[model samples]
Target: GAGVSQSPSNKVTEKGKDVELRCDPISGHTALYWYRQSLGQGLEFLIYFQGNSAPDKSGLPSDRFSAERTGGSVSTLTIQRTQQEDSAVYLCASSTRTITGAVEAFFGQGTRLTVV
Candidate 1:
């Protein structure tokens, strides 16, 4: 059983470049979520995928941010035209979709993106 995994534990990028961060959720988990937590800030939900459909994308800051999950497992957050304000820890989490209230998200260490 594997937990969520994210690549480029640290990333330094220019102010206007596109970046793609990868996430591999735990096996058999049907729910995936992406969140952004800036320095000294709370987590902000970016997108959510329950199975193949993303029911919520309201947390995306702007047109530059997008995410997609395939086969209900792996997900990627793509930031187009990175900005300095976008520098934050991108976290990925997954949980089993249960009718009970016991479902909890297991988060990855997160990809720390630094925009310069």
Candidate 2:
């Protein structure tokens, strides 16, 4: 894909259900990130993947939230036992280099998850 691509633009799940969101980053990009945004809140970093080594899972809010990147190309975010508080737009981004430098991250349209 030319930029980051996220699946199932919108999803509605029960409060206790589990949901999986997918992301496909730009080809050759080395950095992938997952973020969450609530109705009026700012984007919160969820996880980061750099190359093929271990991913930086520091930003995950709890044990229920997890993500993995495969082959340095695609990534998935899984939320277990979803809660109403989990209803938000999940964004995925990828950059050619680490975010600290001058490079800019290309973002996906985001997947909106609603827990009822």
Candidate 3:
């Protein structure tokens, strides 16, 4: 894709339901990451994937949250039994090399999830 893409820019779900957010990273990027940010809060790392290996899931709040990257590109974040506290914007980023000290990340617009 020309840039990182995310689906369902806005999601509103009832408590205890499930919601799935998707991301499509830029072409040929080898690293991908997921982060969550609450209203007026900083971004919180959720997971990181370097390639075909297992994603670093340490950032997931609990077993209720999970994500997977398929074919080293697209990723999906699934939140099970959503709660009001889970409301936030989910962001995805991809990294690529650049000039010395100039490497930066590209971010998607993000999925705004609201659990009522």
Write down the TM-score of every candidate: 0.95, 0.93, 0.91
What is the lDDT of every predicted structure here?
0.91, 0.90, 0.88
lDDT for 103 (candidate 3): 49
**Which digits, one per residue and each the tens of the lDDT, describe model 1 over residues 43-73?**
9999998987898989999999988888877
How does model 1 score by TM-score?
0.95
- Candidate 1: regions farther than 4 A off: none
- The per-residue C-alpha lDDT of model 1 at residue 95 equals 88
Using lDDT as the measure, the top candidate is 1
* Clashing pairs in model 2, backbone N/Cα/C closer than 3 A: none
Give the deviation of candidate 3 from the true structure as CA RMSD.
2.2
Q: Report the error of model 1 at residue 9, Å.
A: 0.9
Q: By lDDT, highest first, what's the ranking?
A: 1, 2, 3
For model 3 the TM-score comes to 0.91
Q: Candidate 3: deviation at residue 54, Å? A: 3.7
Q: Write down the TM-score for model 2.
A: 0.93
Superior by TM-score: candidate 1 or candidate 3: 1
Candidate 2: residue 90 lDDT (0-100):
99
Tell me, what's the RMSD of every candidate?
Answer: 1.1, 1.8, 2.2
Give lDDT tens digits, candidate 3, residues 9-113.
999999999999999988987788899999999999999887655447899999999888889878899999999999999999887644552247899999999
Model 3: weakest 10-residue lDDT segment is: 95-104
